[model samples]
Every structure is written in structure tokens, then in C-alpha cells.
Target: MTIFACMPVFCAIPTTYLSGSAAAGGTAVINSLALPGGFVSPAIMGWAKTTTGSFTSGLYMMAALLVAGGLAVLLGMPARTLQETR
Candidate 1:
């Protein structure tokens, strides 16, 4: 519920800032990558639950991945250089 609600808002952030081809390409790439995760994540969660006999470990792992993804976006995504801004 929360994830579904937040995803559109989060996706909107990039689209609001980017323009033209960059905006189109960026959203396209984001959607393309995210589409597969929908399938893959459930498989992972199911496997984790089967192996551990509970969802706790899988939830924790998902939380850890979320943290890692946030860190990657914060630290790894390059800021626009002055040359590009002009």
C-alpha cells in the first residue's frame, strides 16, 4: 500500500526536473528496470520464506536493499555540472 502510493510521487520528482529527451529516456529506463523487479522480488520473498519458515528475514533483507538503493542514489548519481546547466 505504502510502496504503491509512494512510487508515483518518487517517479514524479525526476520527471518534474528533467525535460525533453532526457525526461523521456529517464522515465523509460526507470519503468523498464522497475517492471522486472515486480516479478523477481516476489520470487525472492517466496524463496526466503520457504527457507526460513517466516517472512521476517525477507522483510529485513528488503529493508536493507532499500537502504542500499537510497545510498546509491545519494552518493553515486552524478550532479549536473555547471556546463550542463547552462
Candidate 2:
């Protein structure tokens, strides 16, 4: 519940940057990629909490992952608008 609180923000990213069928594809790709993380995160968090006696370790791990993903998008994504690409 807490993890998914920002879902609306997540949903908006592809739509903002993409257009037409590309937007649909982008959304599909993003959600598909997130599927595994959705499954794994709870288990990992649970384990971390059990080990550390708190969720802080799991929260830090997730934060690190988010930061790494953001950096990846910044560096690897092409520097062009949808119109330019078209």
C-alpha cells in the first residue's frame, strides 16, 4: 500500500514522454518490468525486517534501487522528444 501510493505519478511518466501507440507500449513495458519487483520486494522487505528488527534496511535498499533506475533513465534514454523521434 505504501509502496504503491505513488502509482498515479508512475502512470503519468510514460504518458508525459510518449505519444500515440508509443505511449501504450511504454506503459506496457514499464508495468511488465515492475511485475517482478512487485513480487520480490515484499519478500525481501520481510526478510530484511526480520533480520534487522526494522524496515529501514529494506527502505534504504529500495531507495538505492530507485535512484539507480532514475540514473539509468537519465543516462541511457535518448535525448529527444517524441516528435523529434518521429
Candidate 3:
């Protein structure tokens, strides 16, 4: 679980930085500047109102979820292993 949780933290490093940059650049740059409704759409929707802060907050939540999901998977592995052992 610990290792799994850490994986998100590791993955988050780049995302965090990117999110910050996107936020600093504003929603126009984050959304319109990038691919047409490819990835920026979600970022814009998540950010809402095209604000850097909102985008950062949204990305933070996403990163946290990534960590949580990783942890869940990691934790589940042990349980599954134990079950098979039994």
C-alpha cells in the first residue's frame, strides 16, 4: 500500500508542475492553446472558469486520487495473495 501510494506521489511530480504552469498561464492558454478539446477540455472543466488556481486545485484532487487508487491496488494485492495462500 505504501509503495502503491508513493507511485502516485511520483507520478504527481510532473502533473503538479504542469498544473502549476497551466494555472499560471490561465484557462485560455490551458484550454484554447492546446489541442482542440483533447486534453485541455477536462482541465478547463475541472478548473472551471479558466482560472489558474482552480486548475491547480482540480489537478491536486486528481493527483490525490491517483495516489489513493494506487494505494488501494497495492493493499488489495496483499489481500489477494493471502486469500490464494489460504
Candidate 4:
């Protein structure tokens, strides 16, 4: 369900900054960027669990990254893009 919502936003990114035609390539780039984190996140979480005996620190770190990414999108994207998306 979240993927349903996320893909359009994913597409919107390139459409916003570049062009509608760039979306497919942009999505490929975005997916590739996400690949590293997907691999690294679980290992980091596992390390946190082993070293700290809990997932709290790992979860907090992920949450912080989420907030930072959202902020970067909000600040970096053009104001008109926000209005058009709505």
C-alpha cells in the first residue's frame, strides 16, 4: 500500500526537477541510491541489537534519517513543484 503511494512521489521527483521524460531514469537512479541503505541498514541494526541488546538506537537512527530526507526534499525542491503536486 505504501509502495502505491510512494511510486508516484518517486516519479514526481524527476518530473519536478528535470522533466516528465526523465522519470524512468530518475527512478532507476533513486532505486539504485536506496540499494546501499537497504543492504547496510539491517547489518547496522543487527550490530546495534548485539552490542546494545535492543533495537531502539537503530530505529531512532532510521527515524532521524527519514526526517532529514523529508526536510531535504522540502527545502531542495522548488516551491512551484509543491503547488503543482497538490
Off by over 4 Å in 3: 1-53, 79-86
For lDDT, the strongest prediction is 2
Angstrom error of the Cα, residue 29, model 4: value is: 0.9
Top-TM-score structure, candidate number: 1
Q: Is candidate 1 or candidate 2 better by TM-score?
A: 1
- Model 1's C-alpha root-mean-square deviation from the true structure amounts to 4.3
User: What lDDT score goes with residue 37 in model 4?
Assistant: 86
What tens digits encode model 4's per-residue C-alpha lDDT throughout 1-86? 64356657756677556766576788779889889987888998999899899999988877787778778878987888679879
Q: What is the Cα-based lDDT of residue 58 in candidate 2? A: 93
lDDT of 3 by residue, 26-51 (tens): 44453353356467548555665366
Give lDDT tens digits, candidate 2, residues 1-86. 74467668667878887899999999999889989997889998999999999999999988888778767765765668534757
Candidate 4's TM-score: 0.74
Q: What lDDT does the true structure give each of the candidates?
A: 0.78, 0.82, 0.54, 0.78
Supply candidate 4's per-residue lDDT for 24: 72
TM-score of 1: 0.75
Candidate 1, 32-73: lDDT as tens digits: 988998898898899999999999998888878777776766
Q: How many backbone clashes does candidate 1 have?
A: 0
Q: Give the TM-score of candidate 3.
A: 0.34
